[model samples]
Target: MPTCPSPRAPNGSSSAQLPVREKELTRQYDLLASARRGLPMVRVDRDYIFEGPSGKYRLVDLFEDRLQLIVYHFMFDPAWEKGCPACTRYVDALRDLSMLTRRNTAFALISRAPFPKLETYQKERRWDRLWGSSFGSDFNYDFRAALDEKIPTVH
Candidate 1:
């Protein structure tokens, strides 16, 4: 959703010195992004499940009839009393969920906290997006979002 600036003449002002190679690089990046969408998907056999707003659901269920799903692995540990402040801030940026739904894509959050605690933190942040807990499951580990049992220092 960004517009490309038009190339300026040699006599143009100082700020108008955008390189022609930059535009070509941008085009190449866009092509790569388009190609990434067509990458082959490996079948998942594990019955990984999560606790959701409406009971428990599997990983595929998170897609919610959409072909593409974006799951943000929130770093909220089970022992933490409150959700991560940084993750909370990132969630605040996704206020408009309709944009993704319109594009046939769904987005959700998965955390390591238990269902009840995850629910409480979500309520405190007043978040409306779909969130689930991977507490009794290996969803986080399988996805490599959670590294071992140690919680990383945020500071």
Candidate 2:
């Protein structure tokens, strides 16, 4: 860790305050990560199928024999003219997947849009990750990523 000398601020605060704050932030982040790692895992038995560029594929197929699989639920509704910008931004971080692959982990993107639309948007965005479509599938609904049409009105 690097520490900088704290110069006196206009309010008479020492510049050294930043190092303390950074250390505190780092400690909090470590604690949060430890708690996250302690969370329980839920086994998924549902055989959900998704549309891929080549053909339909089951959820396990995305892993490609990897020990772990990470599925990113992208916001690309069937009616939308384009994919969500925020979700697309997430893909930028995955440009270099060598680190993840070395750890025996696989990553895939799933959306509610049709395969053709996903393909078009993926090409436009130039994303190299595997993208799948959950259209006509209960995946989005079951995963709580998409809302159902029937909302029970409160009396």
**TM-score of every prediction relative to native:** 0.69, 0.72
For model 2, the stretches where C-alpha displacement exceeds 4 angstroms are 1-36, 147-155
Q: Which portions of model 1 miss their true places by more than 4 Å?
A: 1-40, 149-155
Judged by TM-score, which candidate is best? 2
Instruction: Name the 10 consecutive residues with the lowest summed lDDT in model 1.
Output: 146-155
lDDT of 2 by residue, 42-92 (tens): 888899999998899999999999999988888899999798888888886
Residue 113 C-alpha lDDT in model 2: 94
Clashes of each: 0, 2
lDDT of 1 by residue, 1-155 (tens): 99655555346655365666679899998998888778798888898889988998898999999989998988899999988788889998876778888999999899999989989988988888899999978778776687475644321
Q: What is the C-alpha RMSD of each candidate to the true structure, in Å?
A: 7.6, 7.2
